[model samples]
Target: MAALAPTAQAGQGDESRLPKAHSWRQWLDREAWRKAIIAIPYLWLLFFFIAPFLIVLAISAGTSQVGIPPVIWKDTFPFGTFDNYVFLTQDDIYWQGYLNSLRNAAISTFFALLIGYPMALGIARASSTWRNVLLLLVILPFWTSFLLRVYAWIGLLGNTSWFNRGLTSILATFFPFWVTGDHIQMMNTNFAVVLGIVYSYLPFMILPLYATLEKLDRTLDEAAMDLGSKPWEVFKDITLPLSLPGIIAGAMLVFIPATGEYVIPSLMGRGDSPMIGRVLADEFFQNRDWPVASAVAVALLAVLVIPIMIYNFFQAREARRGST
Candidate 1:
């Protein structure tokens, strides 16, 4: 009985110590590895993404001294004044440029949405093998230089170019006095600028819409049809609602950058149609007013950030609901 008691006590002691068998050193080693893996991406983002933005913010707030040095930081931060913004608001040319930019960007975004939606829908409905080919074709333009593409537009719209001449000649042959050189000057017009923007940013709209639409169930549309809903009704009820996130995302992608687009306007727009982007460039280089240029950039950023945050919030909420 005494020997049996000693054996039972030994068993109890071993059982009591089993949970603590994992040492603090082993636990720490495992945790350290986990933490390192998690921290690497955040560290990279902080250094690359956050740091660059902070620097830009700093520069935008500071004053620029042209001859002595390029930029000189004021003793007071944000300069504690609205001089930059004030200058922009008071100037008639600057205000006109701002309004022109908004109009061009909004119109371009609308046209891009209209053109891209059908193409995206067709691609989503295509067979798997064909879909890849279609997607490849859609993205193919991006591989070519964007600057080269804009330059190509210049040739297409130039006064003595094939397109303009062909149209004028055809109109003259058919309608005689109906169309003339003065009337057909597509080159360096607002129309040309809008067309260029739509052509360039169409891909941004297509890709996102494709992403959302492809994942949608085809039966939803079929069910709508089965219930006697018209094609437009089905789109309004099911398709549009489901695809709202993509639409918003695509619009934002095009609209935000289009607001600040310099190349398209510079290449395609009339000199009289001064956009905010061109104004910013002229301020920086031609006028040599670095402080004003920085102010413009900062203002642009401020205008864009709020809507983007709201969009992200709604998107996240919708995604969560979909998952559940």
Candidate 2:
């Protein structure tokens, strides 16, 4: 305390201390601004996504009495019982529809994957311009109205329509034995529904596979070739393993929502060809049973959530394995 510090030492200490404080203050300001910016999107998602789901959850737990409102919740608790779920279990129609939806989705996803994989591979191997053009063609269908496309399929599959008529005429000319009667009715058949689902969801499968395949290392293929592996062998050993994530992702995308699809089935299937989506819709509108519809929806969500979670778990596991 009695001796004064050297001016040069004092100046150095002040310089270091001042800059550290200033930098920290600046960092705090930036962080505050960044947090403010982030808060906007977080708030928006909370209000939009979380709020709606909560409302649905609330409604699902409620019941519609004979004279009361459709959804009854008293004192912020679900006064209504689990009658909806019980009804669903008792109803053979609901169970049948659920199983049928799963079957249709699985079949449609299989076909979509079979067709889309080759298309995606072709696109990935093409030159940039050609790839872009092909991709445009793939997506071009979406530019038109979805309803119109479904309607067009109806026309194409109709017994007297150009497609079936042309096929019938050509087959009759070449091989009469192969050709059937005057009309070949594909409309209102399971085949038509499958076709519609595949057509609608094929692009979804293709684009993801293409993106993944395009980013894959060509060196892996070259190495497999150098190792005296055949093309199919190389694909099975190298390409397929590496592209598994994309394949799973694409399959999940097409399969999950397709299980609950309504529009395509309505357009192409018979009235009795009940899918979960159709049943859910009917419960809401035709039957005027909100609680039951909500229960059906919750069940659908539960079914989808399990597969999605499994897919995500596998994806994460793969990512961790890759990282290590």
Which stretches of model 1 miss by more than 4 angstroms?
1-45, 73-80, 169-178, 310-324
Tens-place lDDT digits, model 1, residues 1-324: 777987777888688754555677776779878989999999999999788777666666666776755667766644534576788888887878878888999999999999999899899989999999999998899999999999898888888788878888888888886875533788788888899999999999999999999999989999998999999999999998999878988998999889888999998997986888998899888977777787887777776787778878997998899999
Give the C-alpha lDDT of model 2: 0.87
Give the C-alpha miss distance for residue 7 in model 2, angstroms. Answer: 17
Task: Write the residue-wise lDDT of candidate 2 on 219-292 in tens digits.
Answer: 99999999999999999999888888789889988998899999999889867868899999999889888888
Q: For candidate 1, which ten residues in a row score worst on lDDT?
A: 74-83
Provide the RMSD of all predictions against the true structure, rounded to 1 decimal: 5.6, 5.0
Cα RMSD for candidate 2? 5.0
What's the lDDT for all of these models?
0.85, 0.87
lDDT of 2 at 203: 93
